[model samples]
Target: MTMEHGRAAGTTRKPKVVFVLGATATGKSKLAVAIAKRFDGEVVNADKIQVHAGAPVITNKVTEEDMAGVPHHLLGVLPADAEFTAEDFRRKAGRAVARVLAAGRLPVVAGGSNTYIEELVDRDNAAFRERYDALFVWTDAEPEVLDWYVALRVDDMVARGLVNEARAVFVPDDADYTRGVRRAIGLPEMHGYLLAEREGGAGEEELLALLARAVGEIKENTCRLARAQAGKIRRLSGLEGWDVRRVDVTPVFACMKDGGAACHQETWRKLVWEPCQEMVRSFLEAPGCRPCSSIRPARR
Candidate 1:
């Protein structure tokens, strides 16, 4: 079956991976299992914790029974003390994805580590630069105009009492000046700005507080968008009978805090099963080209 964004249509490539990420204690494994079962997908581990062989309990590796007939890869493959880097993960994950494609099954990567997902989706292309140019056409305008606009925005913020004028300095066309405004205004470059500031003698406490607020805002916005996107993807893909949902399962681990062999089944249901089910059902009902899972035909 073929799928297309606009005019172009071709075989629907199925490197379709769903990554589940959240903090420690999130029920990432259970969710991966449910998604795998529903979509005929396989789970690929992205958690650094679950990679260690001896610390199954400590790392919370998915058990055999929990797999529910779904295939899982990369779990318990590393020793606890061995260092694993993002580069290592990206290489291994790429291979796993290829293998999953060869086996005619979907590959689902799940974990709480954000670094894993970021690295997996990182694109080395000019698309980002093009996007930036398109969004800010006047970015290359006269330095005076750019400076005036920046100063205006900063001055407005100052009037609103959001910044301390005594510490803030405005320099025309300066990268630091632009970065500072971006941070003060709760923009995406805030993290980079904060890091730079910290290295440049910013007080730890003040920087931390600013970072906390920025992070909270980012999380709230991200969660809102994720919930909406998850729902939309489920609805659109379900009608076509192709499972395309991924979840972030972090709460499951939290429920295990007291420490015991007993599992937090409720957390699993709420954080993993429910979302997976929703997506699976939606995909099964949506209208679209089916994913190609044939082993007979090889890509040229």
Candidate 2:
């Protein structure tokens, strides 16, 4: 068996990994980029779907423009049809983190996938696992606001050729979701509409109505996924192994909607970035050890 060590003995300190985790549309990727920019960090994806090559539309990939010149790894690298397990993420993310640190950069694991993040952080190789100074940052929003964001995002996906994206990977009604991209949230939700449209039995009006209904279902399903993610984070935050901090982004979004990008950035810096910045700064200041959680999640 081959074992990889994260750091050499007598090295100044083991590398630290900053994980920005949350449900879809919670600005996890944006905040990760902010931290990476401030701390000279690179992003290693923990979202299973985004790791797959192609399907950027379906997986909601962070655009290169939005990345603000920071490097991102483990994104769109795997084949779209490939089966990626948590263990797979562990191996790839570990190497990504090591390489980032080797180049004198911090590693930011940013994504909405709780399982992949947990596996990479805690369940990976035992030798290197102990050496990692890991910090978990969770982004959250109000339930209604999350629902609205998800619904709007689904609408945007439709505008961005979501139907075509679904058609490329739609499966049979009885198809098992475990295979290929069938497991993706939007694909399964839009499968019926794609199939009906391809079959050419439904009239134009009926097809349009079906498409509308499918989009609605996708929004509803996405909200459910968000709730499930919250439950996962709740359990994860209670664990004693890793330092966890949760940031509620509802106010930021509201400011953005009412004000603009400038206002959003300011609010983000105040609420999200500064706290994470303090954590990263403290971790770098006290190298070779995990930073204690200084900010706790808001009490519900």
Model 2 agreement with the true structure over 86-154: per-residue lDDT tens digits:
888888888888898888778888998898877876674454458777777888888888887788788
Candidate 2 accuracy as TM-score: 0.87
Clashing pairs for model 2 are none
Following a full C-alpha superposition, what root-mean-square deviation does model 2 have from the true structure?
A: 4.6
* lDDT at 31, model 1: 58
Highest-TM-score candidate: 2
Error of 1 at 69 (Å): 3.4
Where's the lowest-lDDT run of ten residues in candidate 2? 1-10
lDDT of each: 0.46, 0.78
Residue 242 CA error for candidate 2 (Å)?
1.1
- Lowest lDDT sum, 10 consecutive residues, model 1, at 132-141
